[model samples]
Target: MQNPAAATSASEFAELPATASHGPLRIEYRWVNETACDAPIAVFLHEGLGSISMWRDWPQALCERLGMRGLVYSRPGYGLSTPRPHDVKWPVDFMTAQARDILPALLDALDIDLPERRSMWLIGHSDGGSITLLYAALHPDALAGAVAIAPHVFVEDISVESIAQTKQLYETTDLRAKLGRYHADVDSAFYGWNDIWLNPAFRDWTITSELAPIRVPLLAVQGHDDNYGTMAQIDTIADCVPHAELVKLDGCGHSPHRDAPQALNEAIAAFVSKQK
Candidate 1:
């Protein structure tokens, strides 16, 4: 059953100043139940190819059920935010950059005082999931807990194969057009992610060692039929994070929120409730 408290209160933009290496960016973001000022905040990190609009109402629904405020935003190059330059290629450590630099900058710009208040909760999907893990690892004390949905801890052969197939689809099918609806510059969003993941050098990327330092509660969810990765991804998270919980959903693939939204929402709400 879906929660009836699902309601988005506002959508806005945060203008981020240019950093040493990158230009200024306008981030499109939305807030759910902003009036719940005393409640813990839950930030939603979209997938690699996703945008603020792409998340639809899932963040609102989840925040409503948890009685928490919600923050959903489009990363640079995705949605209404600043688009990636055409000639620029993302580095192999792009996700790390997001976790280390971009996310913190955004939070600071938004006046989110992480250190003073309780650490915020994070709900991340796909690439966002990996970013969430990296952020939690890098700043173990800045997060209350996290939920990683279909996150990649390490690159797998299947991941490369599926990403390659997506590249073909983007080239040959209406995938580009469909994605364009979500991004101001579709190629920036697509190639930025696709190019890096398919790069040979990225094959060695892994956050397994980084996971050992994470001390917060973590719930790792994955689909049994996920084409992009196997159960090893979440299983490894369990092995590294002490008492990390795992949820394996049957009849789902790559995206549990899309495939099993109700179950995902209920599970997350229950897990978060326990933390409180």
Candidate 2:
């Protein structure tokens, strides 16, 4: 509703195939409220290279555990959504675009009006985590709370170097093949994200200043063994928002949902249940 032009950017795919129409992109989302009990909505935001398929069934389990309806979707150029323009690379303000424009448009197309007492809870991982922070900061009242796992608040040399390694793996190994299993068009999703982060302008990306505006309760988690980000990311978040809590997982890497499902799920369930 906010940016009609951005919302309709993917309109050509509207007549394409099987997918949920969120704006012009086809978002794959699963809704399960079998309990018929009134509960809050939990929006699950995937990692940079993640999609609904990559999330597997974790979202469903979390929703059932907490008795909340869940919303999960792939952004444009990912999963079942439309492919991105090949020549277009992600800009330095990519996160800002997602927060100020794309996310709101998606919510509008979904026909969801913000509730008063308990707003939608966000569970975001990695890039989704950063975008969640951005969204929470901009529309603090729209969220009940949020849980971010291994979110990046600032870009570091380690991340860029690691991403470079990943690019090599994508070309030399079966990494792209593995991604193919989860994405309908793995290249679109992969390149759209990978190239943006690797862009020269992306090296200085930081959302800490924006995060200070977040008024909702937050729970941030990071793996001790996470190769993607440093503890400073969550540390900065807690520093910025006094109400934020940080959890450090041991023996875990980037994908905490898969590596430590029980712990992650339990923590999230507890956090969402306690939301007021």
Candidate 3:
């Protein structure tokens, strides 16, 4: 296996000479260099504990296959981006901060203002899927379409139980040590997300009501054997968005890109191509 740190390099990006904001919390982003194409720019959102580096070669492969520009970046506390602040756990309004605040701010900071000139196509996984739904709902007109893998729309008993199990693994296993390889500060990313989700107040978390407002064409997908969430998660998305398409992959697991790459790629490519 390759060293995770050795995998960190700007050349991996379609656009080099990385552009970033070194503000209170440094955020790095890149815009593909080629002239804009017909397909919406594919913005890959990582999973709950994932960062851009953790995505490995998946985004690059997807962009090439779909013939679209790719935008992949670390959230506030993941990858090589700035660490989360020292004083706080994830706020109750964390999703809002990601959708209403961080995303738009990143776009503005990058000067990607005109959605009509070049719209976006969101491909999100896990918690990133939730954030995508929230964004599409709040900014319905901004995207051409969206695809979410193993998305969670509401807190479920299964989800809470799974997360509790993850907490135990974090404490007793090498999970934390492994996570340290991907994040600049493991605690910033881990605790910020873990502590909040496991908090009692978060049991009532639900984005289904907020997601109903999204008018874009949505493709909700899930693995048959996903360890983290249930099929009901993506099912809820399709139910809410009448036009949403649902695809269930057999013999697959939590990480579709990892467990079912061929199927995931074909589905996304088809959805994005048809949107043109």
Candidate 4:
């Protein structure tokens, strides 16, 4: 409740036409400061199991701080986007695939052009943070800057342990019902992320080596109290991308945006300002 927004953004669905990689997804999204014609755009990437609504007013609050246009959306298998079929299990490189394929497709579907992309910034959290880094590495010139909060570049024991616990909570607690308020197909969203994370093959997954090519201004953040990961996540990012700036919030958790929104906003705003 500390982070507040005066603007009331609204959501709309963008219908992505079929692409060779994957498509025809109906993505629910919201725009902030859409009428700010000359301002740079900030496209938000939600965390794994996150959606447009799950973001709450934080995106709006941040965009207002930076005086930038913003776009927030639900990924294909989550939120109000086309839900994943029950039989389909996500591949190990699903996050990368989203950065490489789905994001660009969504931007195209929304008529965001190369010029706009060059001025855009990606603000992602958790799994969305991973996607932001992947996108930066894969398409360096496509965006002006990026902020990755609590991104995982490699699979860690703590990550697996926490995820396993989350799976148990999902099954035994009211977590499903809680998340259902944000996702259209709660089971599809929950299982799609949970099953793949718990899969044995996912233990060897790592994207730490793939970040050498990212040239955009990047800010990597993590909370000291995060149950889902450790400071090593952002430290490893600094190791891979030497130019990256890091922010470690002491009293925060897995979701820095929720735990320390003001600090997160200040870090991002300062990072982007330096880029300018």
Residue-by-residue lDDT tens digits, candidate 1, 50-166:
998888888877887898888899998889888889888888888888898888888888888855324589899999999999998998888899999999999999999999999
> Which pairs clash in the backbone of model 4?
none
Q: Count clashing residue pairs in model 1.
A: 0
Q: Could you tell me which 10 consecutive residues in candidate 4 have the lowest summed lDDT?
A: 1-10
Alpha-carbon lDDT of model 3:
0.78
TM-score of predicted model 1?
Answer: 0.94
TM-score of each: 0.94, 0.88, 0.88, 0.96
Better of 1 and 4 by TM-score: 4
Model 2 stretches astray by more than 4 angstroms: 1-24, 33-37, 116-118
Off by over 4 Å in 1: 1-10, 115-117
- Which candidate, 1 or 2, would have the higher TM-score against the true structure? 1
Clashing pairs in 1: none
Best by lDDT: 4
Q: Rate the local accuracy (lDDT) of all candidates.
A: 0.87, 0.77, 0.78, 0.89
> In order, what is each prediction's RMSD in angstroms?
3.6, 6.2, 5.7, 3.7
Task: Kindly indicate the candidate among 3 and 4 with the higher TM-score.
Answer: 4
In terms of TM-score, the best-performing candidate is 4
